[model samples]
Target: MELQQMRYVVAIAETNSFTRAAERCLVAQSALSHQIARLERELGAKLFERTSRRVRLTPAGAAFLPAARQCLDAAERAAAQAAAAVGEVRGRLAVGLIPTVAAVDVPGALRDFRQKYPHVRIGLCVGASDDLVEQVREGALEVAFLGLPTTVVPKGVNTYELARDRHVAVVAPDHPLAEESTVDLRRLSAEVFVDMPAGTAGRIQSDLAFSAAGLSRDVAFEVTSADYMARLVGEGLGIALLPSAYVPRLTGVTTIEVIDAPSRAEYVIWSRTVCTPAASAFLAILGISTGPGTPDRGPVPGSSVRVAAE
Candidate 1:
């Protein structure tokens, strides 16, 4: 019979009195009796043997009461688990990161988040901004730290400003431009440069800056990863322009300031459709600096603006 009918049968059997069971269940005695009677008629078995003084369980009722209780319990537990999966921060989070963020303090931030929510599974995929955006839009990733400008964030995705890390020129320490506090755009024009591949946000920004200053680029080497770019610069392969923070572990490379091009901002973007508990929790950690983009500065030219997420 109906789950409610089963509940009524179990309640009456436990109390041994329809009146007491109705009171325990917060229902009218007549209603409870009707439900239990309906259950017995549907099952073709009497659930209870009743007298004016007491209600006793029939043989079939004794056999079925525990099963009925278990069924109800299972239903309730399933509902609770579904809610926990939706609202609690205890599940898998798949995230995509750009080259610049992989070099930044995201690992530290994730460590902190893991300490707070150890049960959450964190999966990371590192790629260019365009690729990461595509992953997020396609639901391959829940969210991502992506380089912007040319990326078309799909309609169902949302964006948050994290921090803006500016671009700088990295050269061999012994290069003529290495000692310069800040090089003019004209000085970089004729130099053979190690550049990011054409599709990346850094490449687009670099191209725009050169074009805006009425200069043309001289290509020496091309690489996709920022880490590789740094190594190439360290080896004196050629000068390269890259995000300031992405320059990690520079041995012989010196990062020089770019005096002309600014306005670079980095953001964390995600889907608005839905997010796992782990994804939401990580977003909370990344959004802590919810202010404006930090201005660029440094001995070479590294400035980070810490923006808090709203």
Candidate 2:
């Protein structure tokens, strides 16, 4: 079927409402319906099961959607490559990051990239370090900023170590340890904690540190958001250990330097297969260089520091 038909189908499937899809696609509902009907007739199978209350993909539609999406992405990349040959950099720059990214100011970096390459479409996703690395490797995201324990290395994607810093203790203002200027892991471990979910890259650093010291901690609350973790500490729900860079911005809490705390390493990762021109430009803007490509990547401009992500 036509690319336009595939676009309409994807929009409808994503929105699950014909009216909403039409609004999103900037097309009339009737025209979208007409295109889907025409495509279904040509394929000899209906794509969607429509009812008065809801619209969902049929088995045929579900089977065909993945290829349709791949074709659309490939078409966009082809167009981007063609534009690149003409000395123009205009395409999607999909970047993923963790909530506690501290090395480079993400908003400032993105703002500069936008100012220099106004034609590029920027996309952002926030996730855990492991998930972001996987997204970069799979081509879902062209670049990502991650934070993990110093002992662990990101696998599969190209990585650049950005910064390394120790975690600090966070507690409510009236908490017993709030008056302390510095605390070590032994003292901090004795208190209940608010931490990231178990087994995630975000949690691993602290987990490893405590284990290495032969200490055990009681995690009273587990959350995904760093802000929420801070909030829990502020509310006296529990104390927490977080990257030092993050403590200054948090409210209602007191930060205590931890002399022997877990250390987190920040990294910027990009796809090993294809460093899209847009991705390359963003990396250069950060003064990061991944060197020449290995058959699939485009020319990496503004490259100076050639280094591995490990």
Candidate 3:
């Protein structure tokens, strides 16, 4: 399985059209089809099911897709390591974060990273802490920002603690508790709440807090976006408990300090297995160690770039 053949297969699988995939690969439709046919002949299985109207991966293709992508990533990483060995950084830096990230300015961080390594490509993903951690563990993301209850630490990824803060109550401007300067878990528990989906890391922080306080709160609205949750709270749907640093920015809501609040810790996590040079450089900006051999501010004048991956 040549990388180009695999690339054609991946592009076709993603676009679900031979014509579009050929366009994406910058090759002719017949040439792309010939390659796929050759790949199928070598693998002894059809990779895709082509119909008059649509294209879909066959069972064999489903099994091969993930490994194919992994191969492509590994190949790219190998090239990046070689470049890093010679005072240059070139690779995609995929980053993931939750919407509530507050410890470091993401755009600013990317700006600084770009200024230093213009050759490196950057990508961003916004997701829940749990999901982001999983992405980092899978090497789908080079780094991720997470927020979880202080009691819980991510299981598989390498992490660096950024900061910690208590949860605050968000109530609509016209709600009865809007004027309150401080509240407790028990008090907040008495009211309905708007929160992230149950069982999520973000929701669990508040859940654990109230559960420990022997209080049960009703989560009347389950939303994925924090901004949308704040909108629901603004409409008096329910109150919410969010990290103190994030609630201040929500319009049409009053933030009350939670006297007996749940505290959450922010973490920056990266793949324990593959720490690319670009990733290490980004981490270094935050003073986060990328194990050994991490690149410094930029490429060294006369030295090869440091390869920090374990």
Better of 1 and 3 by TM-score: 3
Flag the better candidate by lDDT, 1 or 3.
3
Candidate 2 TM-score to native = 0.91
lDDT for 274 in candidate 3 is 78
Task: Provide C-alpha RMSD values for all models, in order.
Answer: 17.3, 4.0, 5.6
Tell me each candidate's TM-score.
0.63, 0.91, 0.91
When 1 and 2 are scored with lDDT, the better candidate is 2
The list of candidate 2 runs beyond 4 A from truth reads 293-310
Measured by TM-score, how close is model 3 to the native structure?
A: 0.91
Clashes of each: 9, 1, 1
TM-score leaderboard ranking: 2, 3, 1
Q: What is the lDDT, from 0 to 100, of the residue 45 in candidate 2?
A: 98
lDDT of 2 by residue, 109-137 (tens): 88889999999999998999889888888
lDDT of each: 0.70, 0.86, 0.85
C-alpha RMSD in Å of predicted model 3 compared with the true structure:
5.6
* Residue-level lDDT tens digits of model 1 in 221-279: 88887778878877878898766666654556888878874335566766655555456
Cα deviation of 9 in candidate 2 (Å)? Answer: 1.0
Best-to-worst order by lDDT is 2, 3, 1
Consecutive 10-residue window with the lowest summed lDDT within model 1: 294-303
